[model samples]
Target: MGIAEEQSKASAALASSKTTSSSRDSASTAPAQRQAGKIDVLIQGVALFSDGYNIQIIGYMNTVLAKLYPKQMTTQVKTRLSNSILIGDIFGMLLFGLCIDRFGRRVGIILTTLFLVFGIILATASHGATVEGMFWMMVTGRGVAGVGAGGEYTVCTSQALECADSTPEMRRRRGMLVAVSTNAAIISGFVGSSIVSLIVIAAYGGKPSDGIWRICFGIGIILPLAIFFFRMRLNDSEQYRKHAIHSKMPYWLAIKFYWRPLLGCCSAWFLYDFVVYPFNLLAPTLVSGFSKDQSMISSIGWSALVNFFALPGSFIGALLMDRIGRRQTYALGWSIVCDFGFAIGGSMIQLKNIFPLFVVLYALFQTFLSVGPGDCNFLVSSESFPTPLRGHFLGFAAAIGKVGAAIGTTTLSEALASFDNPTKGQQAIFLIGSAISVVGTLCVWFLIPDAPVNLEDEDVRFRNYLEANGYDTKEMGLSASNT
Candidate 1:
């Protein structure tokens, strides 16, 4: 045979061999077993990394900065530090999203570890250096850690959402993976807050409490290292690899296709952070306003105990989100947030007398807040796009949310500082936050698509197009056009 014919024959033989091998491998595994194992691992990994940072970082940001920059750490300064972290988050999100699909979740995670290490070292080093210099270093450290968090949030979630088998039973199971991270976050928040309270109480007994924040920061470094080492055992997801090879697009085309869902996701996130970021960042100052005495410090301890109540609410929210759908669950959560804000506003108006009432109301707010926004945002954002764009979509969504978070801190700070009475101004901020949350809840309901729970139900408009074009249901596994 001539060379051209020989090459053609050889190519055909290789294709046949690969098909046979693929078929054999598919035949060997029980579908149920394979789906269960992969989805579970995905959920666990996502949960591990998310909770690992949020619990420590979110709980301590206010207190940590307050200790280091007591004189200069106004709400605006605190917000700027937060903004710096967000700047890093934006870069990491784009970088990780661009590469995660192309390279794989495992590789992206390994890269994230480097950012985490750098962040931790810089942040910790701030403590060792002069106080003024430490302020900038602390911001630098948070920025690096944020880059790692940016990678972790998008890549890990996309890996879980995309890799699950396209079956109803498997999809519900897979949804749990997305919830795991937030669940960890809620749990960690409770733990971190408790630690803060314990340190405060110890100070009431004359022990030095100034150093406690440093311990939290030091401990924060350990979680990422542990996650990095654990993730080293995980493999690159098969579905992502398969999709990368089969449907790869020019980068521009992918962005064009995904812009709408991406925008919707990011907008939802922006609203979420508007309340949560500032609330957490300025919590220490807010608490201090009530009292600086031993009794007042004990109130914070009581508040920490109350925060634990949010954990269960989050667990239930995650379960119902998968059942009732993302839109409804999110809208419901925000509605509660708005009402909670009103309650908070009322308590702030009477801060001296209704301290117990404020703590109780705040606890309830924390519960639903922990469960609803965090989990729903991840679920909706991760599922909003096709596998190719999932990482980019989620990364950008998170970056926007961080921006909102940064603004929230500054706005709250300015509001607190400028007010004739800082306490009443806080009440006004709550009222405004309540209105914003309601608007966000409305946006999700009116504008966004009904996110499909499984891969088979996706590309819904495209599915309709296929049916209209005379595609057969059995051959394509697509619904025929009712039209």
Candidate 2:
């Protein structure tokens, strides 16, 4: 069948399934019961706040740590410290994703939370007799925390999307809910880090204080631990439960069936991170580099200010996805917003009199990214596969994306160092980032297919596809309702 014909069939199937599901929905529960489901969705969405907060805290630490331990903040040391969490994330995404697929989402999330708590405690208490010991300790702690935060991507995102799909009211708003949940967490991270920074600076009389960094790391423990209590109370989504009860696709078979989406999601995420992490993690340094007169506090405050603009951009992108479709949103954000921003911003970075212009362009670049591929990537990864493989696919894609983040974080310093002038080096990195964004745009356009998927109908379609392909549906416990 032609691509258009296939899409038309899928849409019709989804519409019919939605109608049927709506009829059954009124009979399935009382009004209070429905209201409770909405509450659950909200809780799950908020669960991501910890992940977002932790990720950005590290970025904020770049400036704070540089001042607190200037001796150990060498380029190599800084790179190691910056990438520790990301290194952990690389493994965590893979491990937690597999755990969710095999053991269940609840189990995976609980374990992830425990790791997060342990990592936070280790990082908060990090100290040693020598600078080496202290640096490694912090790196180790952040790496551990990164593992938990990494797992959150697979566990939390999959759960939020699944929960949204389980409810009719939420299903239509899944794009916004997922995007807002993740982006809100990011915004919270930016806000939380800024508040903590101001408080620490004030208490210490604006001096470089180790206690400030420790306190900031320690504060990350609160939200995750609190959410753990609620997550334990929550149950797996109806879609996952149904899939788990009826059938489990073999790992190899899932790979065989969904390789196209795996490639699309993985590449898209990889490219997004490749461009995003370098700028994001280096935001403080970038701002500081642009204007030598800017203080540490000013640099951090500027970084936070840039992130504030990202909040609306994220919501706008999600809303556009619902209205114009994911492909268009992704393409527009990449080509128009991110690509142009990076190219123009890089070219202008060396302009001595127009430093503020560079900052504005940089902020606009980030804002456009959040609107386009940032949150949309998560939505695409989760929705691209059926329930049985959703976690696995999303996890794998996320893990690979982390690799991109790691590369971006690691190489950015090297890129900056290669040039004599810091501003010129930053210009080089930004131009390179723009080139990478262009490649990412092409990947989204050609590789990622646009399919309007309804979760219930998708499950049925997968079941039938398996059966028609000579797989034993009966053995897998496929039921009429599931089809």
Off by over 4 Å in 2: 1-36, 245-248, 475-483
Give the per-residue lDDT of model 1 (tens digit) for 374-424. 668877887776554567677878778877876776776788777887678
Q: Give every collision pair in model 1.
A: 310-367, 314-371
What are the lDDT figures for the candidates, one per model? 0.62, 0.74
Model 1 residue 341 distance off true place after TM-score fit, in angstroms: 1.1
Question: Which residue pairs clash in candidate 2?
Answer: none
Best model number under TM-score: 2
**Model 1: CA > 4 A from native:** 1-69, 127-129, 163-168, 183-190, 193-210, 245-248, 294-303, 456-483
Q: Write the residue-wise lDDT of candidate 2 on 259-323 in tens digits.
A: 77789889989988877877777878877776777766778788777766666788788788777
User: Alpha-carbon error at 238 in model 1, in Å?
Assistant: 2.9
Q: What number of clashing residue pairs does each candidate have, in the order they appear? A: 2, 0
C-alpha TM-score for every candidate:
0.80, 0.89
Model 2 residue 7 lDDT score:
41
Please state the error at residue 132 of candidate 1 in Å: 0.9
